[model samples]
Target chain A: MNLIIGNDITIGYEGEPVVSHLTFSVESGDYICIVGENGSGKSTFVKSVLGLIPPLSGKIVFSGGLRQDSIGYLPQRSAIQQDFPSSVTEIVLSGCLNRHHRLFGYSREEKARCRTMLERLGIAGLSSLSFQELSGGQQQRVLLARAMMATERLLLLDEPATGLDPQATAELYSMIDSLNGSGITVMMVTHDIHPALNAAGKILHFSHDGYFFGPKDEYFKSEKGMTFMKEAGHDHH
Target chain B: MIITEILSYPFLSRALFVGFLISISSSLLGVSLVLRRYSMIGDGLSHVGFGALGIASLLSLSPLYVTLPVVVVSAFLLLRLSQRKGGGDSAIALLSSSALAIGVAAVSIGGVNTDLNAFLFGSILSVSRSDALISLAVSLVTLSAYLVFYHQIYATTFDPAFAKATGLRCERYNNLLALLTALVIVVGMRMLGSMLISSLLIFPSLSAMKVARTYFRVSVIAAAESVAAFLAGFIASYALSLPTGASIVIAHMLIFIILSASGLIIRRIHSVIS
Candidate 1:
């Protein structure tokens, strides 16, 4: 099931183009990691896919016939304020803000779904805790839980393990692997390649100059991939 | 006591009602401003309102008519300039400083026989029926706008990129929030005086955030706190024959300190228990 297709996509800010002539198709249940340098348009590509930035020129087709509500997005946790004074439950409940509900408030079923998603993510105990008080790893889990409350088909994560410790990173990736195994498509943008590259089936290498779309095995086999990794001082496993 | 005399007067009742209405609008708008990190913009816009008031008094026009449009237009310009990629904070600071300077100049230069004390410290006794009606109308409009666009505001405030990706028009709503903030400042100036209005905008909301876990609860508590502060300040001012605006601001600060201390204590206890 093809969930997203971008043909000849070009994205950038008002004056300059960041990434151009990019083409890719993501299927349901496919776990893809995008790797690039700091200014390499990885986040831009993700944002473009999510319709945050209008492509300079291209067509993005959502072939699975999924509505906007079916898309779950976990943005960079650092981008949000930790001391925002919202409970884990309240933050998670915001994922359902777009859903149809009664005139009064969220239905009991919605509340149950929120609780279930938190429990499924193994953070049910943090439900009543202030979101700001959670550890970085715990905060990411709560955000993931919130995203799950919105959709089960596709999860878009922007650097889910950027600030986590080694142990936490391993745990987070394992969780992601399990989620992918359960048939949820995951697209993540990250600057660090080792962890995500090992976990992702497909690696999308991006740069301000261009991008390469291929499987992980083929990526390491290419000359450009070797040169790119060598220049960044990262050895391939 | 002076408090007993003020409490027994219908004029004092009217003043308290006006204060309450302005506080509600300020607290609600304050949440959006704080989240956007434009908390200082409240102070800036209030200063602009002061200039508008001076202009209005000089021209013998109703201060509300002159100040409302001036402050709203200033807010619009502020939003417009801030939307440019790297211009947000600088633009707000520039506008605020210029507005304050111009306001001070206008008040001094106009040499209008208007009572400067009433303009600076607030003269609740001078709050006419028409001013009350205007305050009520502004409150209704601001509240209705908030209720209607609550989801959009929440989305944009939490994650602008996500909100944009999800097909929500963030710029429009962001500007609308700014416009509402301007309206609240203009309306609140009559109660708190332009110099002190921004305190009413920020203090209660900050205090509420110290304790409330959800945005909804924070807003509710903020509104309640603002009303309480207004009542206490009004009574204190009457009792001590102090300046009403200063008294109200002091009351709000006192509440914020008390609430913040209690919140700290509760958090320590929770950590220990957990």
Candidate 2:
């Protein structure tokens, strides 16, 4: 399945559009990374794609038999209140609420799926622990497990490594790489570009004015990309 | 001795039944209010409800019937006004204050001679059979709605963006919460009084969070705390001849302080052990 975008798209509140005239497409098994500076509409673009924010113009068409239930979203780790009183198991089981299991109950298959996802994410032992008591990296891993509970077809991530240490970031990236290797389409929005570039086949670069979408190699060769790299004080070797 | 006398009186039996029903409903709604950080909205809505009661009394209408619709409409209006950007707190403040002022003015202008003390301070003896029935009905309806929309409510509360992405109508759930809050406020006012009803909604939930590890646990703890406070306040009011509302609020506050202190101590012990 693939997500297709065509023509000019505007996203923001009632006054002014944050990102305008954006067009892109993502086929199955594409590891796409969205990079830009703060307030460059990176999160806004991701939110718009997920239908969290309504687009002012243009259209987003999901082709290749992409079902809404199969899409998994991992929001920015900071966006959720860590102090929220819920267990790791409860949070992961929430992802299965859309599957029409039973009224006010999770199915046996759903419970097994949650356990399997937690085990895959190396958090099976933390299922009974309060989510608020977890370390930052562990919490992120738990949230990622929660996101992966329903399906493995498509994953959307927003700044998955913002609060993690370098080692933790490396570990998370490795998990992301493995998920991508399993043929899950991964789209991520992040300010940090290097780690993302290593795994992403395509780059969606956003700026104050507009954005560019194409192969990551071609983006690195472009003048704007080179200017962005230089201004960011990074040597893209 | 006071407990013995309270149990002997039929009026006190009615009062306890009313208190129990209202506490259960308030604690359930309190979970959502505390999570949304709008716990104080309960206080604001109760003050508005007091105004509605005063107007009903002045018009020689049944206060229960008049206040129910008035509080429900006010709750709806509060939700609508707060949804507008930059108007949430201000709108709540405006509605609460205006309702209070209008209620006092109406009572004064009508030269009402009814004992308004019970409405403000609450008196267990003042609870009637009709009020008890109303409270029971409200509790049942609220609990039923909670069961029916538990998933939608959970999805909306934890993550609005994901809820919308998954095509859940979050706005409808928000309105349902507001309506439920209104029903709880109107029914709880008889036992808790308008001035102190918010304390019943906030304190138990705050106390529950100190030890509970999950939302379900929090709900259980909060309900237990609320019931305990109700019984304690009822007994204390009977013994000391104090206002029911003040006694209940004081009981809740005392529990909140004790729980908060214990939570801190437990955290320290855990850290030391680790």
Candidate 3:
């Protein structure tokens, strides 16, 4: 089933229309990798999808029982987070804030689920430790656990592997890949192509040339995709 | 002995009472403010309140009635300015200086009889019964708001993007924080003065962060530390014949230095042990 459908969507800054009139649909349990250059309206597009920013034109419809708040999201780390004073458990528990209805604090049920989530992500022991004390990889894993607490059905990660070492990056990709295997739809934005291509079922590449959205093999066949791939390949080599 | 002296003097009793109440909310709200780098909003709002006080005294109205709404509106405006990308410092500077100019002008023109120095530097020793009552009321409201919306505030402070994605109206919480801050600053400016009240918001929170790893501990420690400092300073101000606000700020500075030293020592110990 199509969890999200966008028809003739135009995302841009200051009403200039950079990535204009691109129609796409994301299916349930499908993994989509969004590859783009720095200024290709990717962040703006993602914010529009999250309802943080409205699209210049057209609308994003969330069907198949998916609410906007129900989609778990892992935003790229900001400078404010680097030295932020917070414990791992506190951060993970904050992810369940959407489900929390009563006032005061988290419920006992939510606490248990977060504990289970930390154990699943293999960071239960670190839950008591401060976020600032963790390594880059451990911090990403903790964030993934936090994101998962928001929703089990869909995860939207924006450059989740920005600063991790190769080993940590690989583990994060596999962690996400396994989560996708468990029937959660995964949409990730990344600059890393080969690793993303390995895990993603579909590719949405945004470039100065144009925007291309299709299955992985079809994306390779597309004009912009082929050009981006060659350029990315050369850069990496 | 100190208790006996405090009971005998209305001024000392009022100062201690109001100062403690203001410290609780100031330190609690300070945690969020300092972490989010909005500490200067306290400074800005107090200046706006000082300006409003100038106007209130000129018009023969109560200072709280005038300063409260004006400072609160300025807070909301500051919050709006901060949300617009970056450069919060400029906006705060522009507004605070302009308001301060207006305050000085107003006070000089019509209300020279009112001591402008007291408003700028605070006079904890001059706290009135009415001022203490207002401080008590506002402190209770601010503290209760913090309690009711504790988790929401935590999520918003820690990760606003994730919080916004979770259908939390971060603006409402942010505005609530601003409103609470304005209330506390206005009530606080009565005794701590516009110049020194921001120290109450900044010192305890930063000091607590040195020792506490978690946000919860940071908050608890900041409150306890702020109240303790205020108590010590209040008594010390009386015993030594020093300015109450200055003594309290010095007390905070002393505690901050001690905690930072202790944190460095603890980290060194860990490095050696490990």
Candidate 4:
């Protein structure tokens, strides 16, 4: 079933269109990789999908019983976000901040879920430690755990591996792949698309000329996909 | 001790009571502001308070009535400016200098030089009974506001974009925070004065951060540290006949230095043991 559908959308800032004429749908358990160069509106498109920014023209409908704020988001890490003075547990547990209607403290079940998320992310031992003291790989894992606490269905990740080492990148991609295998839909935007390209069932490639969105198998045969692969020196079967 | 005799007086007792409340409120709000790199907003808003106080003195009106709304509006303006791209530190500097200029002009033109020292540096003896009551009431309100919105404040201060994506109204919470900060700064100005009030917000949070790792502990420790520093400063000022604001600021500085030194010593010892 289609979880989200974006029809004829134009993502931009301050009413000036950056990338226009886009259409896509995310089905359940499908992994979509949005690939593009800098200033290609990949981030803008993701922001629109997440409802962080309003689209200039088209409508994004979230069907299949998804609420407005139900999508989990793992934004790119900046220096200020990295230096946040919070514990791993506090950071992860805050994912449930808007999940409830009440304004009081978290329930016992919510606390239990946080523990489960930390354990699932394999950072259970680091729950009490400061988030900033962790390595890049650990921090990303903690963030993933936090996002997981928000929603178990769909996740929107914007360049989740921007400043990581090769090994850390591999580990993060593997984690994402495993999550996709467990029936969660993922829409990730990244410039480094080679290693994670295999996991994506669909590709949304934004370019200076225009944009393309389709199944991965068809993308492999499309002219734009072929050009993108050749330019990035990435081989896809 | 002379401190015992000093505390017997109603004015000194009122000063201490109001000072304690301001210290607590400022430190509680300070942690989130410092982490968000918006610490300078406190200083900027205090300057706005100075300007409002000048106008109030010229009109012979209640300073709190004029200063509260002016500072609160300025806080919101600063918040709006900070949200815009490329309007961070420079905006703060511009607002602060303009307010200071307006305040200086108001004082000179109105010829309120007799009360200039009190407005700039603060005099505890000059605090009227009604002003103390206002301070207490506002401080309580600020404290309650922080307590009720602690979770939202935590999420927004850490990562506002993520918080907004999760359906939390981060901007509203930010505005609420700014409003509370304005209240605290205005009340604190009565004791800490305009020139030295932001120190109450900055010093405690920075000192607490040097030792604590978690946000909750940092806020709690900051409040304790601020209250202690204020008491020490007030007592020292009375004993030595020093300027109240300067003395309080100096005490806060000394405490910060001591905390930093202790933190360094502990780290060194741990390194040696390892």
Interface Cα RMSD in Å, per prediction = 2.5, 1.7, 1.3, 1.6
After superposing candidate 4, which stretches have Cα over 4 Å from the reference?
Answer: A101-103, A235-237, B1-3, B270-274
Model 4 C-alpha lDDT per residue in residues B1-274, reported as the tens digit of each score: 8778877999998888899899999999999998887888888999999889888888888899999999999999998877778758788888898988888888888996967778888888767899899999999999988987888899999988888888999889999989999999998896777999999999999999878878888889999999999889989999999988889999999999999998889879978998
- lDDT tens digits, residues A1-237, model 3? 999999998987778888888899999999999988889878887888888987899999999999998789998976336777899999999898888888778889999999999998888999899999998889988888998899988899999888889999898899889989989899999989865558899988888777888999887777776777787774322
lDDT of 2 by residue, A74-122 (tens): 8877777777888888788877666655776677889999999998889
Residue pairs with backbone atoms closer than 3 Å in model 4 (clashes): none
**lDDT score of residue B122 within candidate 3:** 84
- After superposition on all CA atoms, how large is the RMSD of candidate 2? 2.1
In model 4, what is the error at residue B213, expressed in angstroms? 1.7
Stretches off by above 4 angstroms in model 3 are A234-237, B111-114
Better of 1 and 3 by lDDT: 3
CAPRI rating of model 4: medium
Angstrom error of the Cα, residue B128, model 2: value is 1.7
* Candidate lDDT values, in order: 0.80, 0.80, 0.87, 0.87
Docking quality category of candidate 3 according to DockQ thresholds: medium
Query: Model 2 in CAPRI terms: which quality?
Result: medium
Model 2, B27-99: lDDT tens digits are: 8778877786666577778988889888887888898899899888878787777667874888789878898
What TM-score does each of the candidates earn?
A: 0.91, 0.94, 0.96, 0.96
First chain TM-score, candidate 1: 0.93
Docking class of 1: acceptable
Name the lDDT value of residue A59 in candidate 1: 73
> What TM-score quantifies how close candidate 1 is to the native fold?
0.91
How close is chain B to the truth by TM-score, in each candidate? 0.92, 0.94, 0.96, 0.96
